[model samples]
Target: MSEVAVRMRLLQQSFDAFDESAAARLGLNRTDLRCLDLILAKDPMAAGELTTAAKLSPAATTTAIDRLERAGFVTRSRDAANRRRVLVAATEAARAAEREVYGPLGEAGTSALRRYGEEQLAVIIDFLETARRVQEEQTARLKKLPVRE
Candidate 1:
C-alpha cells in the first residue's frame, strides 16, 4: 500500500481507539455511544432514521434511546409534521459534552484540510465515501455470517 493508504488506515484505527475510550469514559457500551453519536450528528433526526443508520432493530434501538434518555443525553418527541413518527434529539448536555471532547479534533481536521485545494479535497471525499460504503457492505456480510462453535 502507498504511504497515504497506510496513514489513512492508522488514522482510522486511532479514531476507533478514541471512540472506545470515550465510550468507557461516558459509561456507555460502544453501541450506545454509536447511537448517541448518530443523534448528536443529526440533531432532530427521526427515530427510524437513527435505527437505519445504526443498523439496529426497532426494539434494540428503543432500548438504546431509552438508555440515553435516562442519562439525559437525548430526548424523544412526536414529530409535529408527522405525529405517528418519533424524533430523537440530542440534549444540550450531550452536545456540550461532544463539543468538549471533539471540538479540538474537528478544528485540527479543518486546519489540515485548509492545505488542500478543491480538487484534492474532492478526491479525499470520494475516497472516504467509497470506503464507508465498502465498510457498510462488509459489516452487513459479517452480521449474516454463521458463528463457529
Candidate 2:
C-alpha cells in the first residue's frame, strides 16, 4: 500500500478509538452510540431509516432504540404526517453530550481547514466525498457476500 493508504488506515483506526471512548463516556455501547449519532444527524428520522443507516437488523435497531430511550438519549414518537410510522429523535441530553464531546473537535477541524485556500478546500471536499462513496460501495459489497462460519 502507498503512504496515503497507510495514513487512511490509521485515520480510520483513530476514529474508531475515539468513537469507542466517546460512547463509553456516555455510558453506552458502540452500537447504541452509533444509533444515537444517526438520529442526531437527522432529527425526527423514521426508525426504519435509522435501521438502514446503522446497517443493523430490525431487532437490533429496536433494542438500540430502547436502550437509548431508557438512557435519555432518544425518544420515539408517531410521525406527524404518518401516524403509523415511528420516528426517532435525540433528546436534549444527547444534544448536550454532542456539544460537549465534539464541539472542540469541530473547532479544531475548522481551524485546520482555515490553512487551506478555496481550491485546496474544494479538493479536500471532493476527496472526502469520493472516499465516503467508495466506503459505502464496499460495505454493500461485503453485505452481499455469503455468511462464513
Candidate 3:
C-alpha cells in the first residue's frame, strides 16, 4: 500500500477506536452517537438530507431517527414548504447530552492544538484542506459512476 493509504487507514482506525470508547461511555452504539452528533451540529434537516449526511441507507437513517425520537432526543415534523417531507430537529435533551459527551474531548483536542505554534497550525490546516478537497473530488467521481452490481 502507498504511504497515503497507510496513513489514512491508521487515522481511520484511531478515530473509530476513540468514537467507540466515547459511545460506550454514553451507553450508545457508534451509529447512534454519530446520528446525535450530526443532528447537534445542524438540526432541522430533512430526512433525506440526514440520510446523505450520515452516509446511511434510507432504511437505516429512518431507523436511527425513529430510535432517537422514541428516546426523546429528537423530534420530527412535516416541513412547512413540503408536507411530504419530514424534517428532523434535536431536542434540548439531545443538545445537553452531546455537550456532556463531547465537551471534554473538544477541550482536550483544543489544548493539543494550542501546543502548536502559528506556523505549525497553519501547516496542519493546509494539509487538512488538501485532504478535504481530495475526498470531495473522489466522492464526486464515484457518484458519477453507474452502479456495477
Candidate 4:
C-alpha cells in the first residue's frame, strides 16, 4: 500500500482505540455509547430510526433505551403529534459526557486545523470526507456478511 493508505489505516486504528478508551472512561459499553451518540446527533428521533441507525434488533433497542433511561442518559416518550410513535432523546447527561469526553479531542483538532493554510486545510477536508464515505460503504458491506463460525 501507499504511504497515504498506511497513514489512513493508522488513523483509523488510533480512532478505534480512542473511542474504546473514551467509552470506558465514560462508563458506557460500545453499543450503549453508540446508541447515545446517534440519539444525541438526532434528538427526538423516532424510536425505530434510532434502532436502525444503531443496527440493533428491536428487542436489543428496547433494552438499550431502557438502560440509557435508567442511567439518565436518555429519555423516551410518546410523540406528541403521533401517539402511536415512540421518540428517544438524549438528556443533559449525554451532552455532558459528550463535552467532557470528546471536547479535548475536538479542541486539539480545531487547533491543528488552524495551523494549516486554506489550501492545505481544503485538501485535509477533502481527504477526510472521502474517507468517511468509503468507511460508511465498508460498514454497510460488512453488516451483510455473516459472523465467523
- By lDDT, the best candidate is 2
Candidate 3 is scored at a TM of 0.79
Give a tens-digit lDDT track for model 4, residues 126-147: 9889989999999889989999
- Candidate 1, residues 39-75, lDDT tens digits: the string is 8889988989999999999999999999999988999
Candidate 4 local distance difference test against the native? 0.89
| Clash count in backbone of candidate 3 | 0
Ten residues in sequence with the least summed lDDT for candidate 3: 22-31
Candidate 4 clashing pairs, residues 3+ apart or interchain: none
Q: Cα deviation in Å at residue 56, candidate 3?
A: 2.5
- Candidate 2 vs candidate 4: the lDDT winner is 2
**Predicted model with the maximum TM-score:** 2
Count of steric clashes across candidates, in order: 0, 0, 0, 0
Question: Which residue pairs of candidate 1 clash?
Answer: none
Candidate 3 per-residue lDDT over residues 1-149, each given as its tens digit = 49978998799798899899877876677887888888887888898988998899999999999988887889999999999999999999888877787888789899989989999999999988998899899999999999998
Q: Model 2 off-target regions past 4 Å?
A: none
The candidate 2 region of ten consecutive residues with least summed lDDT is 1-10
